[model samples]
Target: MSVALDGVGFVHANGHRALTGISLSAGAGERLAVIGPSGAGKTTLMRVLGAALHPVEGRVAVLDVDPWKLSPSALRKLRARIATVHQAPPIAPRLRVVTAVLSGRLGEWTLPRAIASLLHPSDIAGAHEALTRVSLQDRLFDRCDRLSGGQLQRVGVARAMYQRPALLLADEPVSALDPTLADATLRELVAQSEATGATFIASLHAVDLALHWFPRIVGMREGRVVFDRPRDEVTQEMLTALYANEHTAQGAADSAVPMHLAVCRA
Candidate 1:
């Protein structure tokens, strides 16, 4: 399995629980989408899978290594094989696109080489190749600050591609993109994972895109997995339930299908 979480649970420093009993597994080359409303623990799940956050009460094996159990250097090595694209692209404002893309290999490169590469990007061709996949090669020399939110998101995708990771995790990757651009970007991400036989998992609020692109769908609600099923098997009823709020007057029980969640059947 590329990722495995056994009874995972996470709590914030503020004593708020973000996830509970998140037992899930995904194999290599599998494409899965996590769909949920805001504060549904979707981002927390992504962080746990990417090994960026350790669960307080469960075991996690990413790329066959338990990140929390490994030595510092060993954990870093394990993390090098995993790539995560955040909702916001974490690129420096003054950094050129090429430099940001090349930063994907900083984990693999030596300290001296990495420092030199940052000063003078020696992998221009490689960076350009990655950018071209996301149709952002024209912005290779542009500073990150000059790019729009969607463009910056695409740069994050390009960097993930350059990493050639065994596991790719994206959190709301297409939130800033238009419908057409979102579709294209998702296609590019899936294509890269398919070509490399890497595990691809994305947390998305767009249910239509998730159903259209991913074969497997995992629904999250209130820090729990509401349902995990094939795309074809996910029903509008499930979606309504997944997005239900007990505090609201219009709960899932009152929600009608083929209306608000018509896209699930599409």
Candidate 2:
């Protein structure tokens, strides 16, 4: 298995319980999507899976090893095999695109080489090649601050690609992109995952896109796994119920598929 979690739970610093009793497992070379409403703990769940946040309860085993049990060096080495693309990539604004993409290797590079990369990007061609997958090769040298939101999102994806990780995790990776670009980018990610036989998982709010792209669908709500089943088994009724409280919390339960979701699904 690429990932295994048993009775995982997490709490925020502010005393909010973000996840509870979340058990999930994914096999190598499998592609899955996590779909949930806002504040449903999707992001928190991804953080736990990525080893960025240790679960306060239960166990987490990625690539068949427990991350929290590993030594510091071993943990870093294990993390190098896993890559994450954040919802809002925490990249420096002033850094050039190529530099940001090359940062993916910081986990694997040596001390001297890592520092040297900050001074001068060590592999311009490699960065460019990764960016090419997202059609951002033309902006390889541009400052990150100069790019639009959608472009920055793509840059994050490119960096993940450059990492060549065994386990890939993405949090709303195409949220800022237009419909066409979002579809194209997701197709690209799936293609690469298939080529490399990497375990790919993404958290998305777009129900249609998640259903169309992934074979396995995991639905989350109130920090719990409401359903874990094959994509074809996910019904419209299930989606409606999953997002029920999200809309009802505001006021009405608008039965229509959300406009924000359609923006990417189209």
Candidate 3:
């Protein structure tokens, strides 16, 4: 298994249960889309799978190595094979786009080379190649701060590609983009992962996007796994029910009518 979670559970310092008894496994080159409401533990699960967090119960293994048992050096080596893109990516705004992309190579570069690259990016050709993959080669010299939100996200993807990781984890990577941009971003992401034969686990809020792009879907509610099935097996009715409860609460909080008018009309 490239990624595996066995009977995992997590409790935060605040005593909130973020994940409960989750077990999942993905082989190389598989794409798994995880979907849920806001508090459904999707992010927590992604953290656990990416080896960023240790579960309170059960175990996690990536490429046959126990994630929690690795020493600092070993852990660094393990992380080189896994990459994560969070909802709000942490790209340095002041850095040139190429420099930001080169940071991905730090995990594999020697100390001196890494330092040299930081001061003056050493692999312009490789960085440009990565940008080309995402159709951003022209922006290689631009400061990261100047790119639009969608372009920034593409830079994030380019960095991940530069890492050449065997496993990828993405959390709501396109949620903030407009519909057309979101679709295009996701298509590029999926295509790049496929070209590399890397396994992917992405947390998504858009059911339509998941169904259209991913073959496997995992639905989570609260802290539990509610369903794991092929996209063909997921019915619209199930998704409708899954989101209805959350939407109902939101609707009540932001009532359609103005409060004063509602009171007067009543």
* C-alpha RMSD by candidate, in order: 3.3, 3.6, 8.1
- Candidate 3 segments exceeding 4 Å error: 248-266
Cα lDDT of candidate 2 equals: 0.88
Q: Give the lowest summed-lDDT range of ten residues in model 2.
A: 249-258
Estimate, for each residue in 1-266, the C-alpha lDDT of model 2 and write its tens digit: 99999999999999999999999999999999998889999999998989889999999999999999999999999999998988799999999999999999899999999989988999999999999999999999999999999999999999999998999999999999987898889898898789899999999887767766888889999999999988766666777788886764222113323422334231
Error of 1 at 171 (Å): 0.4
Expressed as tens digits, the lDDT of each residue in 1-266 for candidate 1 is: 99999999999899989999999999999999998878899999999998889899989999987899899999899989988998998899999999999999889999999999978998999999999988999999999999999999999999999999999999999899998999899999999999999999999887777877888999888898989998877776677667766433124223333333345432
- Sorting all predicted structures by lDDT, with the top scorer first, yields 2, 1, 3
| TM-score quality measure for candidate 2 | 0.92
Regions more than 4 Å wrong, model 2: 248-266
Residues 64-134, model 3: lDDT tens digits? 79988999999999888888877877998998999988888688889999889877899999999989877
**What TM-score against the true fold does each predicted structure earn?**
0.92, 0.92, 0.89
